[model samples]
Target: MNGNRNSQDVVVACSRGITPGMPSFAEQIAKSAPDAADIKQRRWIYIPYDRYTDRTGPLTEQSAAATGVVIVESTAKALRRPYHKKKLVVLISNMRHFALEQAARGVSVLYVFSPKSHGQALVDVQREHALPELTCMTPAERELRLDLATAIENGLQMKFAEDTTWASRTADFTEVYGTYKPGKSYVMDRFYRKARQKTGILMQNGKPVGGQFSFDADNRNPYKNQIPVPKPPKFRPDPITEEVIAFVGETYAQHFGEIDGFDLPCTQADCDLMWRFALEHLLPHFGPFEDAMRDDHGQLFHSKTSVLLNLGRLLALDLVRDVAQAAEAGAIPLASAEGFIRQLLGWREFMRHLHGETDGYRLLAGHVPQEHRRFTQEVSPDRTEEATKAYASAISKADPYAGARPSALGASLPLPAVYWGVKSGLHCMDTVVAQVIQEGWSHHITRLMVLSNLANLCGFSPRELTDWFWFAYVDAYDWVVEPNVLGMATYADGGLTATKPYVSGAAYINRMSNFCGHCQYDPKKSTGPGSCPFTSLYWTFLERNQDILAGNFRLQMPYNTLRKKPAQELMQLRARAEEAIAHLQSFKRPAY
Candidate 1:
């Protein structure tokens, strides 16, 4: 949620540019001020990013009434890493803006732009004032934040307190959640109160705002107007925000995601707009249509809430509750509600837990930097040698029922996919990469069919595939996308998320969509210039790697089809397909 910027005593912190979802540690430290009832207080300081005259004056002006310490600085470079110049600007500018907002909330910000380490900051502070009891920085995820704190603590060496303001000191989410369990009912029960407690969501009758807690089916109707699809909200940048955009561009020049248009919500009001749209219009048709795609609906059926939800702008439980209520209110349906809830509760939580518990944190670790790869959700893969690999991998990784961890992960199964590296062949790397870079989002079909298919087809290296996907995409977190992409999509680690590779021929594409009509190549014509690229590639992929695929039952159809091809005829077909692929690559953009 967007905090009111009117507080005079608040100092908002950041490890990077503070967006709506990102938590500011400066605010946290100030907010965590030792309750004051006991009065055995320590000195605290608040830092801002802008030139400090306005913010710092308030702190010095009001310091007489405020207990302990409070100094507002324009730059907290000492608290952030200067390793990346972009990081410095992002962190400082965001902190500065947030500080101004907090000043509006009545807090002070001392502006400083020195790239000094925390120890140096302490020395400077001591020279300016006296030894303070504590140094509270803003909320930041980069390791440098902690590094700065450690440096300050080491410098102070018992003279001042340095630490995160969070209630949890250890990686003890369990301790924070208390008796929460991972099962369905156990999860549901804990979700009610725990969600509200941790996230401050409003509740009704000891339950969530929505009486029933689901509205999936209602959200699945594909037919437009079945549910009113309102315009998703956007923030028209105020002068301050426009300046922030310019600052981000000039300062954090290399940041991965595009800042152009920069219209995605970054404030509480922005997230609320998205949430309101989902509840009133999308929740009713999100499920059944969740799986469907249309050219006209850029974000059809799907609620683009990842940015908000991940950043804590919107609590997952509250979102679930609202959708459920909407459904119950005759706004949506059961399937859609259930599906949406499952994704939020089951998929998202599982991913967070998986990475938190396993080695999936860094993806693949080998410096080999596997080849780059690409793929998506409406996936259908090649039914050849690659498919055999995919099948074996899937069988090895498949959860027999659901939530049942497979026993064959190591002792009997192929290695799991490391979320590292650039993937090679069979997976289409650039397509989805382009999509994510251009648009801060991707579709399931694009992932499964296009990217995944290309990955297997191209044989792109593993590590490259993993890291590229993780870094480029906005919504990619270690949990879901890693398993889905690294394991299920890329099949980089042999097989982790799927049993077999998804491969298909011209027929399959024809079955799915009208892509054939718009293409210059004909799906029906093989072994010639007019032959479909997919059809030619499909056979070449099979023939080139028969050793791995000859035995796969799924390959029977395509292989049988290949067997009908005379060697000379197959070579011509391969040539045609290769030409098509080359054509695809030679272009600055995909003509289609």
Candidate 2:
């Protein structure tokens, strides 16, 4: 589809930009091969008409066939970018695909997909040479569409070809955001109304209604009085998703992430179905139990829209609007609308802002001490020892299944024993993630309160915890999950995201759901013999993080609770909690 005439040897220059029309992943793989034959691993990086972007870098690095290509982890690595251009380069790294949209505007083009050190990998191509630059760069789509032009121009060796991939990174940012005033009441009103109107969410005396907003109070109520709602129906698979699943199975079979059967609603039609299930089944009572938890059923009353929202298959405004509409229709109450809206507008946007600032590269730099918990290395229960062996047949890792070392701010916290006692306390955070990889789903509360709260309370490194959030959640993106994990959830990034760390005891879960009643631990006790893990862990957490949290204005009340307790008794409580966590499975659940 590209205008470039293919040569015997096509070399996609080390590029810093990406475009949409470049061949599909499978096709790119075919193109990469000397014979242009079909190969697998082609579709693991593939997204359909929908662009697959992670914003940090391109997807395709080298051509293996006329239709086969290789996935590049990041544009900087792909281009072998230099130190001076590093910061600016990151802005457009793998997110360079949209550069092609600009190319249609008639801008000068000089493209390289990788560095000269990689040799003719991303540069010029000779028509008959063994390897030429017929190469196409695949960066994440959002980067080109969203990042500033100046940022895209940072690391390139400027030269011109009749090339038409990226028109130019020559636009002005001031001229763009300047067109619309952000903080005006009218602007806010319009965005709200637009959200309402887009989703037909709130209808009033005829037209979609306004104000009387956010019935979140209703949503905050616990759902223990109610019955458990069933999971919505799943769409088995369409040809596209089926193909993707198959491809991931063969090629990425060994990749860190999981590939469940095609249960994800990838198409717009499927998303609508999933949305309808939420509205008809989950909405009316969704708010009251939004924050509640179930033992194994993680998504109690929570909106199941994350999978749809992040994939571009659905819009945020519509989602919030629909909840508003449901409230107005009296189909659901106001509290539900308010609570869900807060998640979409308030928290969703907040998370996106957080992602724009950080994406986890800093934590991956091996900065954390090895003494920290090792997840990647831990062979997941899900992986067979044989599969694990084969997966690691080539990798020379100290622990083949081990994950990257966690940062001081993420998993390296000094949690005391009492806090460590609850199975509910900083659960096998990594274990659940391994499950998520296999299942492709984790309810909001599971994500927010379960893993997130546990990690936060247990003193996991904020950065490592944030990375786990990104890696585990299907709906997670830097723009969506970063702040939620880094700021609000973990209180990592040192409190820029939340007012206070969300910490609680078994009592909170007891009050919220039926899970405590079903547990072997007693929700009432702070001491022993199957004391609710939440209780002892709560105290244990307070003891551990007290020093770091002493200056926090929001932690005043909890600190007071800790102060009232006698020191010796506190020490005994903490001791038990620590022993509990190290051998979490050994503890029996006491009768509720």
Candidate 3:
């Protein structure tokens, strides 16, 4: 009903960021065609997915007769690698609900189930439906972009337009950071400030409202049970979503994570509940305790809108706009609003553009030497040969900087079974892993501070850890996970994505969470049998990589401490670190 169509071209909605009322992805395709008649008669918009959800960009249309929309469920993608059960349910249910919603809106929808790859499946849809030419937004993932390109080369006529889901684009990154060179690190704060100036989100008369661009200093306080934590909003599954849960539980039963409490919003109507809950219940206290974690509460004060945003149910710009309005009206603190906005406008966009700048997956293995990288075969047995080959092709051979000097901090250990739900005696490790297993989610701090930090200190391979994060979390995608895992968390990129390593001792964890109180290990003892593994390994990490890290200005204090340590004491610390690594390794389970 949006516009008239006679079917010269069909729009394809790759459902990573497909929501209504946005501009069409075929505008350029329509404009480029010299015949105005050819551009005027568009009748169908085809929406596609594989393994329920895979694409990271959306095809939008404000005016078009989307008489038909296509949704593809590719079994090849599902079996390509074992994914978290909750992740599968979230994706499949959302896609199904989207299709039904479109059908209700009077659009003819074609839902396809195929055993082939995503591109081949799309080609099949185009031929089966007799669609003349397919047009879509450029995908956020490089692999998917290449997949579609291959389909195009193989005779599937498709035109691509820019994706509108992000607040910024490749040009935006270049506008602020200049043309990206391989192995160069871009500071996020600079990009964030520039973004704030351009968007005018928290600005008053060409200046930031609070006289600061970031409230990160005020956002790092530990939770002290000051306010009663609110329970997350749960939407009972409708029959459509229930069917998806049943399908995932029956089909991917062996996949990691539990599907019992599947409460994510699958429809546009339900997305508001989460937004309301976040503003009313979670936003007030979200800033101070943003970094805090508790064993009892899985999500303390975080909004968890990443899944919704990543799923295309909500728009990033809309969320930040509303948040800024709320802050202006005194509904929330300025610090809280700024903190939330910084994540989307700052970190999220930074990660995406950085992923593009560094050439996506190639960033993981290119800088690290061959001997230091962890291939998919060495990390987990669950990935199919096709998946492994695809992964190897993405990272190993296509890297533009494959000959770069290997980082001194690169690790080669098989990802410890501890990451796959094997119990590490440390309460922090167990608590975070249990959260991931149950919900396939944890806040950013838990991800950076606990899970990834332990992996780094334990010397687990960064590539293996990166892959584990991709399959383990609901919000994870290659475009987001690689920068976070390889660049920021593990510092395996030789300081290209992060200024310094994120490693820390038990003291940071103890100050941040209640995990240490319930832990069997003593946080104070670095060498004794009961010493905390994080504390012991942290010192050893410093000693092992001092020569490389000593030159880093940000790491000067730690390096100074390591240099001043007595010879015998440092030797004992190394012995304790070895013991801790052995203890952690003993709990290794086969990767899921």
Off by over 4 Å in 1: 1-230, 252-258, 361-437, 477-481, 502-527, 535-573, 580-592
Task: Find the candidate with the highest TM-score and give its number.
Answer: 3
* Error at 489, model 3, angstroms: 0.6
Q: All candidates' lDDT scores?
A: 0.45, 0.44, 0.72
lDDT of 2: 0.44
Among all windows of 10 consecutive residues in model 2, the one with the lowest summed lDDT is 78-87
Better of 2 and 3 by TM-score: 3
The runs of at least 3 residues in candidate 2 whose Cα sits more than 4 Å from the true structure, single-residue gaps closed, are 1-214, 225-231, 256-260, 357-438, 551-553, 584-592
- Of 2 and 3, which scores higher on lDDT? 3
Q: Candidate 1, residues 563-584: lDDT per residue as tens digits?
A: 9878798888778766756554
Q: After aligning candidate 2 to the native by TM-score, how far in Å is the CA of 475 from where it should be?
A: 1.7
TM-score (all chains, Cα) for each model: 0.56, 0.59, 0.87
Candidates ranked by TM-score, best first?
3, 2, 1
lDDT score for residue 502 of model 3: 93
The TM-score between candidate 3 and the true structure equals: 0.87
Tens digit of per-residue lDDT, candidate 3, span 22-45:
333233122222222323354444
